[model samples]
Target: MEGEINRSVHPIFTRDPEDFMQYLNKQVSVLKEDGKEVTGWVYTIDPVSESFVLLSFTDDKTQLDIVMGPSVRQVSVLDENSETYKKRIEAMFRPPEVEALSEEELEKRKNVLKSWLLKNRLPVQVAGNNGELLSISDALFIEPPYGVENCRSTNEIILGRIQGLIKNMPSDQEEWC
Candidate 1:
């Protein structure tokens, strides 16, 4: 009975990733196993998981839906022309622009962060190739720019504390770069 239901849903379950590549960027109608229907533009389909990321746009807001492979019974392309949502979709997940800092400026930031950590009574040492990484008690490690996001650790409590410290630490510059 289960296999019969799957067969009735759609052959998409057995189809290859390349078979669904044609649906990318096009508006599509997805029929679910439970008989629910969803219509949206195809952002991407995970080649591994076979899940679909769908995009829906309103006047000022854009919504995203992730449909699992197993839940998707069938997928039908609604629009073939890609020009409409192509640019908007590309811009949706684009990283925000940031000014590039010079080697000297990066080094200065690193030094300031190390000093701040030491002042906080947290042991910190410069490590990594070209002394680019900061090792905190050989536990947490921080990469360049030395912001809280650069922190890496398995200990969630220490990581949160370190991130908090970085966030509240006073900066010499007017803008806490």
Candidate 2:
């Protein structure tokens, strides 16, 4: 269940990419079975270890601020010097030495996790007033298998603010944006 917008920026609670990757793979598997929509990928600071990751959203860039206690601002979104870009390119070329999980095994593991997530996860509504496929900013993906509570709070906040912004604007003004 989602709630109304909170315009203030929320503090980033955490930034554990490996944990996110596992959860994503699992969620994707189960969602695909039931034909649910989700965006999934492995995000890494070291592209050299991860492999075969096709780079999408190269044009994507946004400021990320982790404000749980202190303000650690991060420039999120993918770029040439961005972590995603670095890992993806290195992942593309990294050979047999640094593979984390076998592709087949990773897929299987994801299936199991997806099944579990489908059972325990809570629904957090995310919508874009501009009515776009990628308009979601913040959504509470119920704590995953390992109790990672704020897995996506940062993104959810950004998307939620955008939604709030769109809702208050005039129809014609929306198109001009």
Candidate 1: Cα lDDT at 85: 99
User: Model 2, residue 35: what's the lDDT?
Assistant: 41
- For each candidate, what is the lDDT? 0.82, 0.32
RMSD of each: 10.2, 22.1
Residue 131 miss distance in model 1 (angstroms): 34
TM-score of each: 0.48, 0.22
Worst 10 residues of 2 by lDDT: 63-72
Q: Model 2 Cα displacement at 81 (Å)?
A: 21
The reply for model 1, stretches above 4 Å from the true place, is: 1-15, 98-177
Top lDDT prediction, candidate number: 1
Cα lDDT tens digits, model 1, 1-177, are: 555554364455666767878888999999999999888999899876678899999998988999998898999989999778986886676433212555677788888888889988988999983597899988899986677788999999999999998888875631336
Residue by residue across 88-149, what tens digits does model 2's lDDT show? 54455444323554655433433443343343342223233211112122443322111222
